[model samples]
Target: MKEERLFSLRNPWFVVSAGGTALIAILSILVGFVWLPSVHSDFTANGLWGAICSAAGAPSSWYKGGDNVADAPPSNVVVLPPLGIARVNAVSSGRGATLATQRCSMCHGVQSPAGVTAPFLAGQYADVIYKELRDFQSGARQNAIMQPIIASLSDQDMHDVAEYYSSQSRVVQATAADGHDDSVARVLSMQGAPIRNIAPCAACHGVLDRKGAAPWLGGQSAPYLATQLRSFAAGNRHNDIDEQMRNVARQLRPEEIDSLAKYYAAQP
Candidate 1:
């Protein structure tokens, strides 16, 4: 009687098959963990054209005349996993305060007003700074896009660092609507032609948020202000609730953009 042999994995043929399968599986996992991100990002960029084409009811992949990689950062340099803008759990706890004071204060002055563009870090909440620093590393927060610089910090280090900054007081902006007049007031008051059916910039950000994290506008540098506006217009900067900038920026002429920049840069 011929007995049916069990499919023994120990057989040479079976060993080779099993080994090949194992190797391929491992390589696949390695690629997923390490390689595929760059590929996917580039592909998604290309796919954007297809999306734009559909938006315009066209068959071609081109959108608005051509493809724009202008705002897209080099994904190859970005890290994966926690690679997104997110708020940290909490700020400086028991022992982390010292680190924050020594490190963070160097950039942002130790005083209440802090440095020129940097906000005062006296009594602000820790979570806000944590989120911001994390956002800088994760590429979620696009304002600075300080990627490699922030990515250098460990998770625990980030927590301590964010906690320290959060503990500092963020500068509060005061509006004296009647005091003086400039392009700041012009844009905020809607003194010029209506832009994108949008009203003045002051109409929204004029008031402070009890929620925290509303960036102070009046004291921010003109270049910073212009960069933020352009980012909003280009859709590179999202996450704002009302899309205040996107609408406003799209409506601005080049000279008007420069005008706003010059005006805000001169504010006290």
Candidate 2:
């Protein structure tokens, strides 16, 4: 003659089981929607790690937006015929010289002075110079300093400036005062760490072979070069075609970055 329950709603066992199931379901949803996506996004953004993981066929959520490797944007870099050393010298005496004097010399120096806050442009490849200018003007590259200066320049102006700089004599800074051997930097520059998926700096910078629109890094300013490497590593600079610099820079340790900058700065 006990009162019979209509349902299990009042049963302690049933309540516990139902509550546990609800908690499990909520956790599953969070893992699927929130946690998993965040992990995937981080993996994808880590350039060197992503490359390695991708080669190993690790499962990862697809990157959204236009960041997919297969759908990378067309390179804005243009390969121009090499501006011969003689030609650069000749053009530097003309309109190119005028432009450099008026605009570029403030930061880059007139004939490539050493130890400036900005990278020395003298003796840099004309195509490299022109491409950087174009990138700055087109908003492909973001720099608080360069963007405003390049905004008013025409394509022809860029070319003229490039020619002038390419022709000028290169200025070499004194070796790093720290007296470190810099063997690590030399190895990274000449022979990249293949295991880390870093390509040799020489490959693109013309120390070994010249590639399309890659600048000559030899004799660049150490402070400027270090700043740039750090910028690339931190993803603050995204102007490199195909994420080349960004990927390589991120893999470099702080000591390595300092060494590389010093090594290149002292080059002739």
Best by TM-score: 2
Candidate 2 lDDT, tens digit per residue, 30-59? 775567557654333346456456657783
Cα miss at 54, model 2 (Å)? 8.0
**Model 1 lDDT per residue over 1-268, tens place:** 9654446765677778888999999997667445654554322232555534544567653367566655433222222223134443443342346555555566555434444444445544454455566666767656442465566777777666655554555453432322334644465434433412445654444442223343435544455567677777778775443455566676665656756655644454
What are the TM-scores, per candidate, against the unseen true structure? 0.45, 0.69
Per-model tally of clashing residue pairs: 12, 0
The weakest ten consecutive residues by lDDT in model 1 span 74-83
Q: Give lDDT for model 1.
A: 0.52
**Candidate lDDT values, in order:** 0.52, 0.75
Index of the highest-lDDT prediction: 2
Runs of candidate 2 with Cα error greater than 4 angstroms are 1-75, 83-93, 175-180
